[model samples]
Target: MGILNVTPDSFSDGGRYTDVDAAIEHGMDLYRAGADIVDIGGESTRPGAARVDAATEVSRVVPVISGLAAAGVPMSIDTTRAAVASAALAAGASVINDVSGGLADPAMAGVARDAGCPWILMHWRGHSRDMAQLAVYRDVVAEVCTELLARVENATAGGVDPGQIILDPGLGFAKTAEHNWALSRRLDVLVDLGFPVLFGASLKTYLGRLLAGPDGTPRPVDRRADATLATSVLAVAAGAWGVRVHDVAATVDALAVWRATGSPRLAKP
Candidate 1:
């Protein structure tokens, strides 16, 4: 999956493609580069960010969804609001990638159930504004797994078919650097939950911190593509069903090489 964030405050690549034309061109480019799906997000989920109104959120992504859909590229809307998800799907989004995992809105699960589209439910504690306060965990991996499973149950009970659902651990949503690392190290646990797992760790600050630049300062999120690619391939090796990313071309190329060669798709160290 290729990530296309239209919000001006996303931690990475914000303001780079807020225009509909530019965003659509970028989505098409991702399709050409080897992304199986392009995910469009109108809100910035960077920690402590303020929420955008549903109207503005819809405005940011509907046209992109429409253009991508018309171009025959699969598209997913990265939103937590039921209103935005419904609008985007009506406008031609095929998947609902909700980072909140049905916690923010009681109507989201029903919406997905009615639409019958593939729903990507991520493990989240609260909205971006207050999620950090909810990140405390006794066992980050086990707790995340359990919470995600509960979300799957909620979606199922709400009428979303078990087969049409996917799970995401939400690498940077509210996790500390160590928590993210632990989740990345044990992605196989998520895969064992009987649903497709989506890993969305592209260009996150955690990777930047891990792979500091030569100046001894943490690398910027925009400069973490190589590290992101490494994590993508590792996620695949750990049995992740898909990887969400900003630079789809690089990920696709790396995956192609792994698939073409006799090596494992994820080639974990």
Candidate 2:
């Protein structure tokens, strides 16, 4: 999967693809660079960001999705609102990547159930604006797994098929750097839940922090591609079904190398 943020305030790559033509071109570029699917999000889920209205989100994504769909690029709608997801699906999206894991909107499950497309349920405690306050966890790995299981249960109980569900440990949404690292270290536990796990640690704050300078200033977003690639390789080695990344070619190249080394099969738990 490749990340495409169409909003103006996303932590990274914001304002770069807000134009429909630019967004479509980038989506096609991602596909040509070896992304299986381009995950397009209209809202900014970065910490402390304000929410955009549903109509605005739909307007931002539908045109781009329609353009990409016409060009034969597979796409996923990265949204928590059922209305936005439905519009994107109607515009040619084949998957729903909800960060809130069906907790934000009561109608999201119904939308997923009716569409019968893959639904990505990310482990989330609250909306982005207040999520920083909800990052508390005694055992990060165990708690994330348990919370993801509950989300899976909720998805199934809401009439979505178990097979259609995918799990994502929401990496920077509400997690501190430690929490993110802990989850990454123990990702195999999340994969063991029997659902395909989607790891999305591309250009996140934690990666920037990990590469901080001696002055303690975090590395810039553009400078974190290597870190993102490292995480992608390690996540796949840990049995992640897919990785959401900004640099599709780099990740694809790294995974190809890993495959050539036969590390993927050997590294799986």
Candidate 3:
């Protein structure tokens, strides 16, 4: 998976692909670079980012999705609005990457069920505005697992097929840097939740802090490829079903290497 933010305020690639033509071209490039799916988000979910209305979001991503779909690129609309998901699916996106996990929009599960499309429901407490406050948890991994399981049960009852739901841990959504790292270390717990886990830790601020340079500056997004690859390979090592990433070819290559060695890193003595 490749990240394609079509909003002007997305954290990393904001404003770079806001233009329809440029977004289309970037989507094509992702495909050419061996991306299995390109995740296009019209809303910026960066911490403390403000929300954009559904009309503007739909307008931003629908055409790009349509164009990408027509060109044979499988796309996933990274949105929380049922209306936007419906429109993107109508425009040819195959999956709904809802960062809100239906919390923000009650009709989201219905839309997924009605369409029979796989919905990637991420664990979200609230929107960017107040999510930080909701980050407090007794045991981060246990709480996240419980919450995700509840979501699965609720969605299943709401008519979404069990097989069509992918679970995301909501890495940087409401969690602090420590929370994110703790979640990463405990991905196995999430994978055991009876759903395919989607790991999305691409160029996150937590990672920047982790790989900060000696000069008191964090590594730039353009220079975080090594750390990104490490996180991706770690996700795969932890039995993740899939990893949503910005760079596809690198992850693909790493997976290939991983699989060649029986997908194992080393044997403990």
Report clash pairs, candidate 1. 237-266
How high a TM-score does candidate 1 get?
Answer: 0.95
Ranking by TM-score: 2, 3, 1
Q: Write candidate 2's Cα lDDT for 85-131 as tens digits.
A: 99999999999999999999979999999999999999999998899
TM-score of candidate 2 versus the correct structure, residues matched by position: 0.98
Overlapping backbone residue pairs in candidate 2 total 0
Top candidate on lDDT is 2
Can you write out model 3's per-residue Cα lDDT over 98-196, one digit (the tens) per residue? 998888898999999999998998999998988989989889999998888888888999999999999999998889989999999888888877788
Give per-residue CA lDDT, model 1, range 1-269, as digits (tens). 99899889988878988989999999999899989999999999999999989999999999889988999989999999999999999999989999999888889998899999999999999888887778788999899999999998888989889999999999887899999999998888778888999998898888888888688789987689999999998888788999999898899889887777766544434
Residue clash pairs of candidate 2: none
**Which runs in model 3 stand beyond 4 Å of their true positions?**
265-269
In order, the Cα lDDT scores of the candidates are 0.90, 0.94, 0.90
- The positional error of residue 140 in candidate 1, measured at the CA in angstroms, is 1.0
Clashing pairs in 3: none
Query: Given candidate 2, what's the lDDT at residue 28?
Result: 97
List the lowest-lDDT window of 10 residues for candidate 3: 260-269
